[model samples]
Target chain A: MANKADTIISTLITRSRKPLLDEWLARQATMAGSGAIAADGDVKEYCTRFLAELDTGLAAGEVGDIRGAGWSGMRELLEEVSRSRAGKGFTPSETASFVFSLKAPLFALVQREAGDNAARLADELQSATTLLDTLGLYTVEVFQKAREEVIARQQEEMLELSTPVVRLWEGIVAVPLIGTLDSNRTQVVMENLLQEIVSAGAQIAIIDITGVPTVDTLVAQHLLKTVSAARLMGADCIISGIRPQIAQTIVHLGVDLSVTSKASMSGALELALKRIGKAVVERKARPAAEVS
Target chain B: MDQIPILMVGDCLLVSIQVDMHDQLALALQDSLMTKIVETGARGVMLDISSLQFVDSFIGRLLNNIASMARVLDAATVVVGMQPAVAITLVELGLTLSGIRTALNVDKGLALIRRIIDGEEQAFDRREG
Candidate 1:
């Protein structure tokens, strides 16, 4: 029963492939305010490839279950299109519309092929609509997955970029944290700071939190854990960049940071240098007038 | 019965735990460490746990007990060379090891112990003077 309907739909798509591709492209071009901004050649190529795959997929008689072996080629093609469009900055709806716009041209062909037979036209229309709708929704699903993967990778990069540990002196290193300290980011921050401490053989680490916007109890606890971990590594940690508001918040929360803290990075550096028995002294500026 | 060795270096006793220590072995280590501290009159104890990958609350409590015992014996205890994962795990397990000093490695741990002993000597000298 399904085979008969599949055969009819396959014949209609294969016979009118070019006209179907042209009509779909024409509709896409005239569709106002989609804001897709894709090149005309690219859009036409996508439509042509999609129609060819559809012809093959419908001929295989597995239009119902896309996961069936016969539909693998079409599925792979749609996955490719969805991934590329996602990378090319196409919105989900815009990408799905590529598959959706075929309905109009396809329905017209089904109507012409069915002629005056109401039952045949209804059957063809139902099968075509179901197949196209499944393919369209598949593209959307792939597009969403691709977008999520891109976002996850970008988030990892941001986590790494935000927690940079710089060696300030021979025995001192500094980590300037710049975002909210969640548990995951704290793990990164702790690992980076500890690894730097080992490589630099640093005796002191100055964690500057000036860029962090706020300090709740959890943030305070994470900071203390970092300090404790650094202390366990034999490197004393001095927290710098405690603004007046953060200080008030810390006190109000009654969280004992317990470690030495300073108002600024420079102050922390000075104390770090003092602890290491090293002093940064500016060479007395030679009489400025002598050179002039 | 395998025992973790306690080597005496200068005025400090160094115990390098190279095996995955069990509860019984840890308690035995505590006993041996205390006995050695008294016999040798060591001024400090340094436990190198760089090779220990995981430490549970039992080992954590044993470490605290060792530190307290050393303190009562008038000796300072410094735990050195803790891996980063072990440190994080210890923190997560709520074992802060407070009252026990820690160093990054053996060399620094020795330096820390020497400084404490030297400071004590200076204080003693000041009292005599």
Candidate 2:
């Protein structure tokens, strides 16, 4: 009875006039394979239950356009199963297998809907999995829309990190560094530092790392890139706040900071002020050109 | 010493800590502090650990937890007033807080919190107004 019902649901879903029903059945076909279904009876039962609930949704006008909603609803049903006590007790391996089974179907769904952005969606799916791991939540297949959202968020961050902030101070500009200096963040720092240097029209730009924790080779390389860019911009770049550990890391990495002006923040400030030929307090006495 | 008293200033909760705080005390305080941070909807937090002489793995883990929780709550955290000696010891011992906020002193930390919570615009307005 169950095997027959599974086929019926799959057929009805595939050929259903309601977009939601069709989409739902297509999804079912993905999960109802010989081994994953465990039993033909279970597959049929799941399909029957889905069609019944979807029919209720259609009757009440709770869902519109069966095609889109069908796929989404199936995902929701799976989520409910995963959330239930019975679902929670599944062995990690079983749970993983269940999710893995739906991967191809999810990919197909996204590829059909997303068109050109399917590859991007795949990366986002991976990122979402990583994020879920951080939260200690495990799932077999995440909804396509959720993966899209995570991808969108990552893109937004990339834009924000690349946006440079300009800090102008009496013909000198100083970009204060904050937080841990990891490899990725250092890339952002390098971009912002060089761009700000060129746009600010300052002779000296100070990169203060006072707030940064220990620096590794990756960060040192980033700092080097900033210095290179600053010289190219016809401005001197100074690295401030070299903590002992960072200095040690630089030595260990055999990366030279020779071209870069390495100084404490105060020293950088003093040098910047000197280049402008005007001290902070003597701002009124200097001509604009002398200050620049 | 008396138990550390936690205070909420603006979007930040500042905890005045004591020296030689045991792991149990630190963990307990961290829990309450994080709960208060979430409740108050603060954007930043400062821990004044001027009194703490040593921090243990449990305390480190607690700090990391608080930091992680603060992130979920959209709060920036800093532990302030950690003595240089203590800071050095923590680094050497590899006892590091995962997500907790830190500051060097109360005033500087407060300034940092102001910067993080209000941004430059708010800071400018506060100065002018």
Best by TM-score: 1
Stretches > 4 Å off in candidate 1:
A1-7, A10-73, A177-191, A210-213, A281-292, B1-13, B18-43, B72-75, B125-129
The 0-to-1 C-alpha lDDT of every candidate, in the order given, reads: 0.86, 0.57
By summed lDDT, the worst window of 10 consecutive residues in model 2 chain A runs over: A1-10
Which candidate number maximizes DockQ? 1
Q: Considering every candidate listed, which one attains the maximal lDDT? A: 1
Q: For each candidate, what's the DockQ?
A: 0.54, 0.01
- How many backbone clashes can be found in candidate 1? 0
lDDT of 1 by residue, B36-128 (tens): 999999999999998998878898888899999998998999999888777877887888887788888999999999898889899999999
**DockQ (C-alpha) of model 2?**
0.01
Q: After superposition, how far is residue A110 of candidate 1 from its true place, in Å?
A: 3.5
* Candidate 2 lDDT score at position A37: 37
